[model samples]
Target chain A: MFEGGLDLSGAAVRVALPELQRLTNELLRASGLQVDHAAIVTDVFMRATYRGVSHHDIYELPGRLAALAAGKVNPNPNMTIINKYAALENYEGDNGLGELGGMFIMRRAEQLADEHGIGLCAIRNSNHILASTPYVETAAERGYIGYIVTRGAPTMGAPGRKEKVIGTSPMGYAVPTENDCHIMFDACLAYASNGVLAEKAEAGESVPAHWGLDSEGRPTGDPAAIAKGTRQPIGAHKGFGLTILGEIITGILADGQIIDEPQDGTGLVGMPSHTAICIKADGLLGARRFRRRTTELAERMEARASGLQLPGQRSARSRNEMIGAGAIELKEPLLARLNEWSAKLGVQPL
Target chain B: MFEGGLDLSGAAVRVALPELQRLTNELLRASGLQVDHAAIVTDVFMRATYRGVSHHDIYELPGRLAALAAGKVNPNPNMTIINKYAALENYEGDNGLGELGGMFIMRRAEQLADEHGIGLCAIRNSNHILASTPYVETAAERGYIGYIVTRGAPTMGAPGRKEKVIGTSPMGYAVPTENDCHIMFDACLAYASNGVLAEKAEAGESVPAHWGLDSEGRPTGDPAAIAKGTRQPIGAHKGFGLTILGEIITGILADGQIIDEPQDGTGLVGMPSHTAICIKADGLLGARRFRRRTTELAERMEARASGLQLPGQRSARSRNEMIGAGAIELKEPLLARLNEWSAKLGVQPL
Candidate 1:
C-alpha cells in the first residue's frame, strides 16, 4: 500500500512543499471546509505527495470539491461522541471527509492511550480517507504504536462469486523510533490494486497473471476483461477473511452504515467507517525504551532482509528524499486539474 | 489457515472427550508440567481436536514431552509481569509451554479490559501456542473482542531471495455474540501450513503450485522440493511484512530472545514470543450492546457471503457437534501413541 514515486509517465513540475500546502489549504477552505478542518486535510494531502503516494495527493482535489458541492461530503460536520466507556470512544462523523475524521480519531486515541496505556476510537459516517501512513505516523511521532483501518463502499469480491461485497479497505500500523521516526507498513487486502492494473491496461501491457481473474476465477492477464470480473484477494480465503475481519472491526463497531453496499440516489460510495487504536510506548518499560527496542528490531530485520526490501523501506527512503529536497513532483495534468478546481473555488492557482 | 477436517487417510476411532482429557492431563503432568498448567494445556488440546484441528492435539504430546525432557520447556514457569502500564502488561514467559503463556495472556487481558475498556499483554520465552482460536474464544465468551498473535522460529521466507526470516506466526481475533457465543477467525501468514503439504506428500499427491516453490523461486508441485526451498507468503511481501509485524509486537515489546533464529545447540525452534489484546464489548455502549451489533454484522456478512463459507463456520460447526456428541475422532495411530504415553505415565489408558 505504501509505494515510492507515482509511476505516471507524463510532463511534471516540482512544487515546493509550502507553496502546495498554501494552495491546498486555500482550495479546501474555499470548497467550504472550515479553516481548521481544511488544515488537517492539507497535512494528509501534502505529506502523502511528499512521501511519493501521489495518487492520494492533490490529484484528487477536483473530485473532492465536486463531492463537497454535490453534498456527498459534509464541509462542517457535527462530529460527536455517541458512546464512551473507559478508554474506548465511538463517534458519528456526520459524513465528513475521512481525512478530517481520521486525524480526529488518531489524536483522540493517543490522548486516551496516554492516560490508559491503550485506547480506541470508532467512527461512522466518514468518507474516503487517502493514504493511512500520515495518521499512523501521527501516533508514532508521539511514541505510541498506532493502528488505523477505514472502509468505503464495496469494491472487492469474495470467495463464492464475482461480486463486490466489501471495500478494499486500507490498513496501517506504525511502530515508533527515536526522534519522531517510525517503522510503518500499510496495505490493502487485494492482491493488486485496480489503479495499478488500469495503468497497465492504458499502456497496452499484460498485467501479472495472479493480479486478476476472469468471472469464472481463472487467471487472466487482460486487465480490461478482469475489470468486469474480480480482483484477486492476496491469498484467496486468507486475504478474503482479512478483508471481512477489518470490516468487523471498523464498520461493525462504528454501527452506522455498513458500507457493504453503496448509498442510494447519490450513487456515491457508501459512507465510510473507521477505527483507530493506539498503545503507549512508555506503557512497557519505565522510560522511552520501546522506541529503542523497536529500532533494534528494525535494524536486525534490515540485516535479515539481506537483498530483500524491508516493509515501508521504499516509502521511508523516498519520504526523507522529498523532505530534504523540500519539493514534491506533480504530474502536469494533475497540477492543471487542481489549478482549475482552485480557480472555480475563487482561490489562486498553484 | 482455518480449513475443516484433517485430510489424513488413516484408521481412526472415536474417543469420549472426558476419557481423552484425563489421559492428556496425566501425560502432561507426568511430563513435569504443574497440574494447573497441564489443565490449561489440555483445554486447548481437547478443544482443537473437537474443532477439527487435530495436528495440535494429542498428536504432539510425545514431542512436547521430549522438549520438556530436553530442558527446552520450563515445567513450573514463574511468569513474571516485567512491566505493567495501566491496562498493558509485558511478561517474561520463563521459557514455558506457549499454551500456558497464551492462556495467561488471554485471561489477564480480559480482566484488564474488564476494568479499562481494553488490555494487552506481551510475553517472551514462549513456545508454539497451537491454534489461537481457543484463546480468542475465551475473551469472546466474556463479551469482548479478543486478539492473539504468537511467533516461533523463522520458517517463512521474504521478498528478495529464498531464505527464512520469520515464522508463519498464527494469529486470531474473536467478536462476541449473545449467550456466550462468538464469531472468531484464526490464521497463519503462510500460503499453506506445512502439516497439510506433508500429508499431501505422503499420499503421493501433487500439491497446489501456489503452496510451494522450488529453490529458484519457481512454483513447484513437488512437496519435497519446496520443503528445502521457501514457503510462499500469503501475498508475497504483504504476508512477509505481517510476519515481522507480529514479531515486533510480541518479541520486541517483551524484551527477550528475538527468535530471529534458533537457540544455540538445542536444535530446537527459537523460544517463542506472544501477545494478547482484548477490548470490552460493552466498552462502547451500555449492557453489552457491542455484542448485538457484532451479531448483526455477522448476519449481514453471512448474507453477503451467499454461498461462500464464513471464516470459522466449519470449525464452529464441528465444535458444537463434537461437544454435543461428547467425543472426538482420533486416528488409531495417534490414539495408540497417546495410550502408550499414558501407560508410561502410570495413568489409566483408553
Candidate 2:
C-alpha cells in the first residue's frame, strides 16, 4: 500500500485510483446525476488529477456541487440523441454536466468509427468539462485518432481589438503511436488560461504583460486588472482566429447555434458545447501495419529532432513519478479545503 | 467599374470570378492536370485571389507549373478511396497535386454529411494545396460547417527552447451564417508564416523579436537568421501543442506518419497529407429549423458583441474593393515573372 505522504494516522487512508473513482461516482450519484453520468464524470476528474493536472483536479468539486445543489446546473438532464446517420450523430445535452455529455458523445463517435472508418458527434446544452484531453485520449487509447473542441464562458480575448468577445475555447487532438505512447495535444486559445490567472491572484503576483489587458483594453500584468479587462489571444490575431474556429466548430458546426445567452436562461454564462470526431486507423491501414508504421514514424521523428520532446511526454513522465513516489503533493490550503468538504459530506476524512 | 483607390493595375485585367476560374482551369489543363482536377485547383486559386489572399494567389501558378515540369509533383495521379465507413473515408492521393486531391476528399465529406450528420475524410500521398480556408468555406457555402488541417514541410519552433522540429501546420474552420456572412478562420500555429519571412528577407527588414530564432537557436529579428533557425510558435508551449496536434491529425491520424528527418525523401517537397470534415446542420437539426436557429443565433452574437467584427469580414470587404477596382496589385518582379511565364506558354501578354 502506498501512503500518500499525508497525515493519515488519525484520518481515513487515501484510496487508489479505482477506489477514488468509485467514491466520486457515489457522491455524484447522491447529488442526483445518473449512474452512468456520474461514472463518466468521475473518470474524467480522477484521470485529470492522476495525470498530474492539479488545476483541473477535484479542488473545484465543492463549488460545482454547490452549483448543482442550488439548481444552477441541471442534475437530471435529459440528454438525448437528436439526430443520427451512419457514422454521425448529434446529441442534445439538455443543459447536463459537460463531463458526462462530452464523454458519452465521444464514446459514440468511437463506436461509429469502429464500424465505419470515421465518426463525428456534436453536442449542445452542456456545462463545463474539467479537462478536454481525456475525451481525445480515450479514442487514442482505442487505436483511433480523436479531435475535440469546446467553447466556454467568455473569458479570453477578442479579435484584432482587445475586448473580450469570445471564450477561452479549448481544443484537443490525440493520435495513437507504438508502444502505448499516444501523442496528445490540448490547449485553450488564450495567452493564459483562467486557472493561471487564478493562481497568480492566489500568489499575490502579477501576470505576464502579454497575458491580458487592463481596464480600457490596454495590456497590463496586474491580476486585478484582468478581472475588469480580458485575457489576450496567444499570438494576437492568430489566436483570435483559432478561438473563432473553435466556437464555430463546437458552437455552430454542431448545430448548436452560437447563442449570446446561456441555454438555461441565466444570460450569457457561455456554458460549453462540443464537437468530437474519431478516425479508426485500422480502417485505413491494417491494425498491425498501422501500429508498425506509427512506431517507425515516431522513432524517426525522435531521432531527427534529438532534443525535442513529443506532446504528452512530460505529462506521462509526471504521472509515472507520482505513481512511483506513491503520493501526489498538494497545496496545504487545497488539501485542507478537500478535508473540510469531505467532513461536510459525511464522508471519511482524507 | 468602381475604380477603387487601392492599386491593383499591376495584375492582369480583372475578369468575372467565373471567367478567371475558367481561364485558370484552361491553363492548368494545358499544363497536364485532368479536367476535373484542373477545375477544382483553379476554383481554389481564383477564390483565394477573390478573397484578397494575395499571398496564396495565382502568383504561385508559375512555381507550381515549374514543379510539375521537374516531376516534383504528379498531375495525373490515380487517386483512390483506400478505406470507407459510413461517415468516413480514407483517400490515397497517389502523390498528386494537393489542391485537387484535397478538394476531392472534402467534397466527398460534404456529400456524406449531407446524408449523415457529419463526415470525415483523410488523404495521404498528396502535395501542396494553396490555402485551407477554401475547402472549409466551400462547405460553409453549402450550409455545412467545415474543418480542414494539413502538415507542411518541416518548420517548427521548440518549446521553451528555440529550434526546429516540426512544421507550421495549419488548421481551418468555417460555418455558414445569416446575411451571407460565412465565418471562416484559418491560420498556421507559427508566429510568422514562411511567406512573411521570405517577404521580410526580400525587403531587408528586421522581423519582430517574437517572430523567430537565430541560427544557433537564439532569439533574433533578422529574417536571414530566422531562415537559418526556425519560426516561433504562438504563445510558446500552447502553440507548440497546437502544431503537434495538427501534425498528428493530418499526418499520423491520416496514416501518412510524421516525417522527422530534414532531408528525408518524404519531407523535401510540398505540403503533406490532410484531413477534412463536414458537418451538415440540416442533418443535426431539421433543415428549416436549423437554418432559422443558426440565423437567429448569429444575429444574437452580433448584437451582443456590438462593436466587434466577425471572422472574415475584413477579408470580404477587401475582396469587394479589389474586385470593384478591376485589377489586383502585384509586386513589380512578380508581374514581370508572370508575363515571362505567359510568353513562354505562347499566351497573350497581360
Candidate 3:
C-alpha cells in the first residue's frame, strides 16, 4: 500500500506527538468512549501516524468518534473467553474497544505460548483495530513470532467477480531480530488499500488498472472509478484465494459477523473479526540460539540482497525519525477533518 | 507461478498409472533407496502428476535418483525428533526421505492437534518434498487447516539486487470443504518456477519479461536466460518479503542449510528444509459446526464470485478427470529420461 510519494508539505501541519495523542484521547472520551478505551485508540493511532501510516492514524478519529456517539462502539465491554482449547481460544469482543480486544487477546496468546509452544485466539464482535502492528510488535518485544489477521468492511471483490464480497482482510506478522530490530510484513490483500487509492485520487492521479476494477468488473486506471467500485486482489485469483481463507478464519471460525453485502447508506459501524497467533521463539529454539540465528538470518539475507532494503526497514527508519523530531506531519485536509470532529464534539483541537 | 501455458501434448507420452508408479519405485530402489522410501517418493510423484503439476512429478525422478547415488539423498536415514515442546517439534531429516519425513511429521502434528488443538513441526536436512500438497491434504482430510513452508535452492533475486538470493519458497495451505472437495493454495514466491520456464524453452517460446532475469539481472523474456539466471518474484518485493519469512521459518528455525549464493554448474542437489503446521478446525469450532460453516462459506464465496472459479477448483477438476482416465501423461522428453534412468539401472521401463 506504499504508493504515491506525494509532496503534501505545503498543505500539511506538524503537531507534537504527545499533544496530538492527548487531544485525540480527550476527543474520544468527550464523544462518550471510556477512558481506557480512548487511551488504547489514541496510542495505536499515534503509532500509526509516527510510522507514516496516516490513513489509519488520527485521520480515522472522526469516524471512530461518530461510531462511539451513535452507541455502535460500546464504551464498556464485557470481554470474555468463550471457546477455550489447549492453545486455541475464541473470544467475545462485546462490540467494544477493538484496540483493547486486540491487545488483550495477543497478551493472552503470549501467555499461552509461554506455557505451550504456540497459541492462537480468534476474536469477534469488535470494532476496527486501526492497525495490526502493535499487537505483533508487542510479541516481538518478548522474542516471539506474532501474527494478526482481521476482517474489515467490505471493499474488495473476488477474482473476476463484479461485486465486492470481501474485506481488506489485512495480515500482520513480526519476527524479532538482533539489536532490537524486528522484521514485520503487514499488508492488506488488495493490490492497494482504499486509503492509497484515495491518496492517489486526492493527488489527481490515475491508479494502475490492476489496483481496482470499475463498476463493470473491467480494469480501470481512473481513481474515481476505483473509489466507486472495488479493489482487485494483490495477485489476481491467488490473492483472492488467500482472502477466502482469511475470511474463514476471522469470520466463520470466530463466529463473527460476515459482510454478506455492503452497507451503502447505513452510518452505523459493523463488528469485524480478528485472530492473533503467537509462537515462542525461545520454546522452539533455545532463547539465546534463536536470537543469534534470527540476526544471522537477517544478516545473511541482507548480504545476499546487497543494495535491497529489507522488509520493515523503512518503517523502523521512519519511526526513529519521527521520534527524534517529536512531531508528526499530516496533510492539511486530514488536519481540517480532525479539527472539524473536535469542534463537533466541543473539544479543543491541537 | 501461473504464467504462460504451453501445449506439451505433442511431446508427451501417456502411461498407465500402475505401470508408471511401479517403474518409478523400482528405479528409486535400484538407485539404493529403501523400498519404503521409494514408495513415498513414487506416491508423491503420482499425486503431482494426477493434479497436472507434472513439473515436480516424475520429471524430478532422474535428479532424485542421481542424488541418491551421489549420497546427497540418504537411502536409509535415522530420522529423529531432536526438539519437542508441547505442540511443536524440530526434526532432523537425516538427509533422507522428504516425503516420508513430511508424512511422519504431519501425522505427528495431527496426533498433537487431536489432543492440543494445534501442532507444528520444523524439519531440516531433507531433500525436496516435490510438492507440499499431499502433506497438507493429508491434514485437511482429518478436518484440520494445514500449512507447509519450505526453502528451495536460490532461484530468485531480492528486490533491486542482482544476485539470486532466495528460493521458490512455496507456501502450501489446505482446508476441507463439503462434497469431498478441499481448497488448496500451493504457489512459489517466484512469478513462475524454473520448470515452467524450462517447459517454455522446450516448446521454443519466449517468456514474458516479468518472469525472470538474465545474468545481468535485467528482465528478459528468453527462457534460456532465466534457466541460467534468476527469477523475478511475484508482486516485486512483496513476494520477496514473504520468501524471507519462509527462509526464517524453514531454514533458520530448522537449522537447515541456507542457500547463500547460486551454485553454478555444480549439478549437486542441495538439501532443502520444510515446516508443517496443522490446526484442528474442530477444536476451535465444533466438528459439525466447522464442517457446516466451511461449506456455507464456500457456497457464499462461489455465489459472490459468479463464474470465476475458486483457487483449487481447477486442480481438483484436473485430478478427477485424470483419475477417471486411469492414465497420466508425461512430456516425451521427461518420459524418455525416466526410461533412460531405468535402463541404466537395469530396471524395467513402463
Q: What is the TM-score of chain B in candidate 2?
A: 0.85
Winning candidate number (DockQ): 1
Deviation in Å, model 3, residue B312 alpha carbon: 1.9
- Please give the distance, in angstroms, between residue A326's alpha carbon in candidate 1 and its true position after superposition: 2.4
Candidates sorted by lDDT, best first: 1, 3, 2
DockQ of 3: 0.57
Could you give candidate 2's per-residue lDDT for residues A1-350 as a string of tens digits? 01122232233334455545555676677678887778788878776676776565565566566677678788888878877767767788887778788898888888887776678788887877777777887888887878888876666656434545677678778777776557777778887776677667767999767778877777787877876678888887788777776776577645664645565455655767898888786776777877776666557556656767777777778767766766565556545655565666665545
lDDT of 3 at B191: 69
Clashing pairs in 1: none
- Candidate whose TM-score is highest: 1
Choose 1 or 3, whichever is better by lDDT. Answer: 1
Better of 2 and 3 by TM-score: 3
Fraction of the reference Cα-Cα interface contacts (below 8 Å) that each candidate reproduces: 0.63, 0.66, 0.61
lDDT (Cα, tens digit) per residue for candidate 2, span B170-289 = 877777766556777777888877777766777889976777788787778898888778788898878887776677557755666475533236555434889888877566566567
- Model 3, residue B60: distance off in Å is 1.9
Model 2 ranges with Cα > 4 A deviation: A1-23, A201-208, A253-259, A264-268, A325-327, A331-336, B1-23, B200-207, B261-271, B287-307, B322-335
Collision count for each candidate, in order: 0, 2, 1
User: Chain A of candidate 3 scores what in TM-score?
Assistant: 0.87
Cand. 1 Cα-lDDT: 0.77
The CAPRI quality class of candidate 1 comes to: medium
